[model samples]
Target: MVERCKACGFCVEFCPTKVLALSSAFNSKGYHPPHVVNPEKCSGCDLCGMYCPDFAIYGYKLETGQAHVATAASAVHRAQRGPGNQSTGVEDEG
Candidate 1:
């Protein structure tokens, strides 16, 4: 989805972890899309996805020993359900 980006820099600018940076490589549309600079630093906050107008990027937290990628939406849903409500479709390996 990097090609779908419009070089708006919103994602890069708003990223709290500074995981993304504008790459020198251009997309098919001749726009400089973002690239992950420090993936380990990413907290999977999904702020990039929330700020992205093109929906080009999003973040997910990977639970240890789980096959599923917990997305931002699911995280929020889990939070709303409060503690002890681990009924998400993605199973926890622990």
Candidate 2:
């Protein structure tokens, strides 16, 4: 998804854990995409994906009992509903 990033820095600037930083390397689109800076600190909150206008980045947590990995598409979908309902973007399957 680095190729989809447009160097807006929203992912880097808005990450709650500061897990992302703008990379010096350029993408094919000539924009600097964000890279993970501190993976251990990442909460997999997907805030970066929520903030990305280009749908470029996302994060997901893995739990012992979880059946499926949370998807970035869900995070992006939730973001469209506005800011008040933010969650971990993990939907439980019944």
Candidate 3:
């Protein structure tokens, strides 16, 4: 959030959890930028950064159940998503 975002809707569209929303205020360029409307629901997927043409916004996976960037959170997300392995399409049976 240091540089001015160019109001490219890529981040908002690519956000898996739909955490971003266009703000009512405009940037220096007079374009409606986005803001985190739902931080708690974010998973730090970073899809926004990958899609953002301006490289203005990015998200960090929060695993501590708190709304902030943390290294531990990233580790937790990695563990949850996959441990460098693809799903085998086999369901676990208890």
Q: Write candidate 1's Cα lDDT for 1-94 as tens digits.
A: 6557787888788888676788787777788877666544566677888888887777765453112212211211122223554433432211
Q: What is the C-alpha RMSD of each candidate to the true structure, in Å?
A: 9.5, 10.5, 12.1
Instruction: Report lDDT (CA) for all predictions.
Output: 0.58, 0.56, 0.53
lDDT of 3 by residue, 1-94 (tens): 4235667677778788786776676656677767666555556767777777775666564453333212101211122244453222211111
The per-candidate count of clashes, in order, stands at 0, 0, 0
How many collisions between residues are there in candidate 2? 0
Pitting candidate 1 against candidate 3, the one with the higher lDDT is: 1
Ordered list by TM-score, greatest first: 1, 2, 3
- Please give each candidate's TM-score: 0.66, 0.66, 0.61
**What's the CA error at residue 42 for candidate 3, in Å?**
0.6
Measured by C-alpha RMSD in angstroms, how accurate is candidate 2? 10.5
Global lDDT of model 1: 0.58
* Deviation of model 1 at 78, angstroms: 22
lDDT of 3 at 53: 79
Off by over 4 Å in 2: 65-94
Q: Return the clash pairs for model 3, or none.
A: none
Query: Given candidate 1, what's the lDDT at residue 40?
Result: 42
Highest lDDT scorer:
1
What's the lDDT for residue 60 in model 1?
63
